[model samples]
Target: MDDLIVKTVTKLIIPFIQLYGIFVILHGHLSPGGGFAGGAIIGASFILLTLAFGIEYTKSILSAKVTERVEIGGVIWYIFIGLIGIAISGVFLGNRVAGFPMGTFGSVISGGMISLITIGIGLKVASTMISLFHHIIEED
Candidate 1:
């Protein structure tokens, strides 16, 4: 952790890792990767940071309160998306029925509410993984 090489390598790779994770999340519907996979990658980056640095250092970067809020917010966002379906179409998770504009096929915005749902899923998964890791570290 104190080594210059480790610090340098971690600092360099962390951004790339996060970028890839976001890419995966954003392109989930178009490609094979989805919210879960992308979120795991992002969470792993944080775990990697914790390993390369120390718990204290990682804590400063992602405080417990912030993590909790993010995790809860993700779920709330998902629920809200579903609620939109109910409110609009009288059905849960209604896509076309909810009148969400589905863009051109195979395009980024083509899936109506799918992209937003996936984003919520990705956020929830990433926060959960980080939270679990943090809890485990704390227990040690």
Candidate 2:
């Protein structure tokens, strides 16, 4: 069935796309890329999969309601993380005191709050994209 084929292809493609996205996000410090760029790539990857396969196929991975909730949750988490710095350091996302080390360049934990922001951005993009895809598919 088309369903099985699409499902198989989507599974095969998602990992590579997601890995590249995360690499871009995490490597933002020494490079031009950042959370936004990486997030966009990841979101676009999902869109590609959706287009290649089908919205119904994609929805099996995550429902519209789940996507909406995840989007909202990511935003709330991002805001909370940003505010934490202000509470203690008297500045929003003040990296010097957010607790994470500004370790050596290229290290696993090099930047402070950068990874957190990247993760938040990635999740936000992914969920928003899912919601959009769901809407588009529903219009049919």
Residue 139 of model 2, lDDT score = 85
Best by TM-score: 1
User: What are the candidates' C-alpha RMSDs?
Assistant: 1.0, 2.8
Q: Using Cα atoms with residue i matched to residue i, what is each candidate's TM-score against the true structure? A: 0.96, 0.80
What lDDT score goes with residue 115 in model 2? 79
Number of clashing pairs per prediction, in order: 0, 0
Q: Tens digits of per-residue lDDT for model 1 on 1-140?
A: 58889889999999999999999999999999989999999999999999889888989999988889999999999999999999999999999999999999998888899999899889889989998998998775
Question: Model 2: residues >4 Å from true position, as ranges?
Answer: 1-12
lDDT of each residue in 40-117, candidate 2, tens digit only: 778777787777677776678766778889899889989888898888788887887866568787876778887777
Screening candidate 2 with a backbone cut-off below 3 angstroms (N, C-alpha, C), the clashing residue pairs are: none
What's the TM for model 1? 0.96
